[model samples]
Target: MGVSLRDVADLAGVSVKTVSNVVNGYAHVAPATRAKVEEALSRLDYRPNLSARNLRRGRTGVIALALPELDAPYFAELSRFVIDAAAEQRWLVVIEQTDGSLERERQILDGVRDHRVDGLILSPIAIGADELAARTDETALVLLGERIHDGPADHVAIDNVRAARDVTEHLIGLGRTRVAALGAQDSAVSGTAPLRLAGYREALAAHGLPETVVRVERYRRADGAAAMAGLLTGGDRPDAVFCFNDLLALGALRAILSRGLRVPEDIALAGLDDIEDGRYSTPTLTTVAPDKAELARIAVDLLRRRIDGRSGHAPQEVRAGYRLMARESTLGR
Candidate 1:
């Protein structure tokens, strides 16, 4: 038979109720008592009976994480952090991909009839404020990313405009005047691109530099390659490039190398999101690194509070922190 709460309590010299309270994450438990209970749990390899616990609590102890693209390294890494944060609270995470489709996002917002999970953490790419405001589902929701600002949910994200400006300023500090931005998009679905572009423009304007933007349908390697190729063949070439994400920057690096032009010597480059690939690229990559672990922790904690009826009626908007990581891409190796 599996070890039960009674076994843990017996080993810890505490009442079963105390063990139960500690397991349930009650804040009132004394630190020493909690530590004792935790040690006992570990010693006995005690696993809580989630089915029985959920039956009593009227919750599934599960949360859904909806992301636009799991294939993207940034999103993939963020998902890992979210899963870790959820696991700390003894919660299970169900990952859902929206494919950056408005219809799919709307479906997720509208359809929560089953109450299969206690709450949801969504990184919306296509959904807007109107659709979010129209959501009728009572399921606790937390949002990630810049899409759907001032919506009816707890939100967590890094400051996109500020981060973008910081990256652009870093390139400018290196004495690159003609810096081109590679990830501008004409689509109304995503809010991230526009905010980033605004930051780049703001930085350039402050330095009295002319703006050069290349629009792409998507922020992919192919798009970056195509955009860089066009920029290279143009009448006036930029002295530097600021890609919206590391993938695009890496792609641009490929295009630069294909043209037999040296990085930093001929043109400096930078990007955001600081994905793993950036660290190992030929010229490396200078990028903005968001505190993804902290972001995930904050999002999960907010959702947990909402699920436990602890969060107040007023929605929360939390901004996570980020820093610029300079590497070989912009600075000489």
Candidate 2:
């Protein structure tokens, strides 16, 4: 009844395929063809039928972004970036949480065949390289964070080990020997936690310091608070603490303040992933800044390319470097 894609294509003097490409936001379409199609659509009042488009393209025009927790400011900001990137290409984002569980990761992977989304950008928890290699055949999977294995799929991440080493070195340079490592873990698959922890240990080794006082946890703000509280009361009190993330660092900040201790003056604190809230926090968080927007841009582009059958470009392992932003939290005013 209403204006159709056919009408727009016919009016534009282009093949239906060309019109489809234009509507789908394909990057390869010429500007002239796109302009003509757009003009014809506007003239005919032709609206896109998303359902029909999905059927034609055999794609849902949706991508899944599986993250750990949206409550964390970093994940929240990361989700926003991914959503914006996908939206520019006329794609939708479906967010999921793994709760840092292996079973949940498996379930998310199994869901790819259901047509909920054409691809996935995963911040997998406890997922191994073998599992990803087996599951990524049907859907385009872009792995994010240190949890992902260096296997198949395009990866977007920062060099966590180097970043952590730099953070530790910075603390060391400040003459803080009794440095406490917060959020340490024995192992993590598909994320930067393990790598960063390894770097922390490496930094300690480099400085000829003991790596005995690591506070392992699930990397939550509460966990940071609890870990810091334990360290404060325990016999081995750290002169400085390096948390795995800003949320944890914030928690530690609260714990340190409650003890009537001055930040940096009593115990210096630092963290990674310089989230938005970190900048505004009292004694603003000192953290490793990753270019989240750029990471999102690359991830969206990579998934789009994979879905479009552009496999000539090999799997890209883009590691965005981190910058140590010294703030009030680490440097006593």
Candidate 3:
């Protein structure tokens, strides 16, 4: 008969479940709502049930890192950095792959996660901010990449538009005209593709150069190979290609070689996410090098702070540093 959760919920003008989310440090709850709940809890002197407090104290001490696809070299490389970073704090990591499916992402967000992990570092691909905002379940989440939603979660990402624009400018600096943007995601409104495409368009406008575009269902090596093949057979082929990622750039490199063309001599090539394979290819790739190690370090540190029970702090939005690596692939051997 003491102050129950229902009383706190009523006082905060939210549901009991929402009050629970606020107390449990869920990510999706609005700042105002969480603040109101905290104020109500203070006024009512609310304390969690003994059993709940004991359960929270018995944390598994592990955390989950979920990405769209681990098969992608960039993600695989990032996993390496994250694992190493987590080891610094003596915490284990659980990796989850969503296979680039919105349904799967929604399922993960549904709170069916392994209770052992204290929190999550998620890189959502198929879901956007609007869809995430509509969800009621809350998790301690730190989002990575260009977030589609503006939720109360920490975000770690690089400036995609600026990176892409710089790549395009590099191509322009190489005296290459008729540059085509390869690996565009078709039938999609969000993701790396849209932002990079925006940069490509921006660079074209700034330099007064016409843009060449090819749309694909997804960003993959196979997608890049196929798109490059089609462009080889079509009219007004490009002299340079700025792919959305390293996988696509490598795929296109193979296609160009098989078609009896030498890279840089025939078409300059560039990509993002300085994956290792791209560095040692026959003609090394030029790319926007996002500091993956720094990204992992910063994100893991943020998660650690939350794990240490730091509360009443606004979520942070951090941008990782990146530099354009002008390699032999684009600069000529």
Specify the highest-lDDT model's number: 1
lDDT tens readout by residue for model 1, 51-122: 777778779888999988899899999999999999999899999888888888887766654767899999
Off by over 4 Å in 1: 1-56
Expressed as tens digits, the lDDT of each residue in 152-177 for candidate 3 is: 67788898989999999999889998
lDDT of each residue in 42-85, candidate 2, tens digit only: 89987878777678768888999998788878889888999999
Best by the TM-score measure? 2
Off by over 4 Å in 2: 1-44, 147-149
Q: What is the C-alpha lDDT of each candidate?
A: 0.89, 0.83, 0.85
- Model 1 — TM-score against the truth? 0.84
Clashing pairs in 1: none
The candidate 1 region of ten consecutive residues with least summed lDDT is: 107-116
- Among all windows of 10 consecutive residues in model 3, the one with the lowest summed lDDT is 50-59
TM-score quality measure for candidate 2: 0.86
Clashes of 2: 8
- lDDT score, residue 47, model 1? 93
All models, RMSD in angstroms: 5.1, 4.3, 12.2
